[model samples]
Target: MKTIGVIGGMSWESSTEYYRLLNRHAKARLGGHHNARSLMLTVDFAPIEANQRAGNWTALGDQLADAARQLERGGADLVILATNTMHRVYESIEQAIDVPFLHIADPTGNALRAAGITRVGLLGTRYTMEQTFYTGRLSERYDLETLIPNEAERADVHRIIYDELCHGNVNDASRAVYQRVIDELAARGAQAVILGCTEITLLIKPEDSALPVFDTTALHAQAAVDWAIEPV
Candidate 1:
């Protein structure tokens, strides 16, 4: 198995899910008590969050690039950033390391395409929702149309993500709020909803949404397993 290097802990809540899903899928694929060959460099999210709030993306990118370099030096075969929002620095991290950097969006986009989903709803931090980095990639690479919540709903989604989900606080009320947003997105003609934020999987599930659900964290982990077991 190839080693999967992870840049994690932008709110270790979702990072923990990445770890669990990676190992679990690896075992499921290989059987016989097999697990992923992996290394994780988890950073403190406090300063990272502060930097994001301050719009210090360059410094944040540099910090994550350093993390990717550390993982590569530690002998990782390929690298993955465990958070969706931190993917704002995807280019920097990709350039920092020699190994393949598995982008979080690729697997999700592939799955969406395989399912014949052309239009999708996205729920993530405001940066991910409003920025061109993520949605533009989907449009340009996958021919997918991305729709997001309205401004007020976007604020609520962002708040629930940082204030509650990041801290491991998953409330039924917040789930209801997310369901409402998903319904609106479906009404807007979204064929499926991308749980664009990694933490969102904790609150919303396949059965809870008005549209089909695509969890990026799960898809990314499964893709890592596929990469690990593929013949070189």
Candidate 2:
């Protein structure tokens, strides 16, 4: 198996999910005692979060690129950025690495297309929702239409992500708010909801939504496993 490098800790809460899912998928695929061949370079989320809040993407990109380089030096064959919002700086990381950088969106987009889903409701950080990096890639690559919650709902989602979920505080009230947002999106003709934030799966699951729910973290980790174990 090829080594899968992880740039993680954009909040250790969700990075833990990536670590667990990667091993679970690997064990299920290869059976018995098998586990993913992986390397991880976890960053301190405090400074990264500060940069994000201040919109200092250049510094964030520099930090992530350094992480990718460290993974490459550690002999990783490919890399996965374990958080969705951090993928805004994916290109910088990619440019800094020789190995393949698996984009979290590619697997999600492919899964949606395979399921014949054309319209999806996305829930993530405000940057992911309002910006072009993620939604634009899905549209350009898969011909998918992405819908985000309205301004007020977007604020709620973003706040819950940073303040609650990233800190590992999952509240019942926050989950209810997310369900309402999903319901509203479904009413607006969203065929499925994309849990675009990696931390979202901590609160919402497939059974929580009326529409089909796609968890990007699981999908992204599974894709990494697939690539690592593919026959050469």
Q: TM-scores of all models?
A: 0.98, 0.99
- Count steric clashes of candidate 2: 0
lDDT of each: 0.94, 0.96
Note the residue pairs that clash in candidate 1. none
Off by over 4 Å in 1: none
Assess candidate 1 and give its lDDT.
0.94
Model 1, span 138-220: residue lDDT tens: 99999999999999999999999999999999999999999999999999999999998999999999998889999999999
Model 2: per-residue Cα lDDT at residue 231:
28
Instruction: Pick the lDDT winner.
Output: 2
Query: For model 1, what is the alpha-carbon lDDT of residue 10?
Result: 81
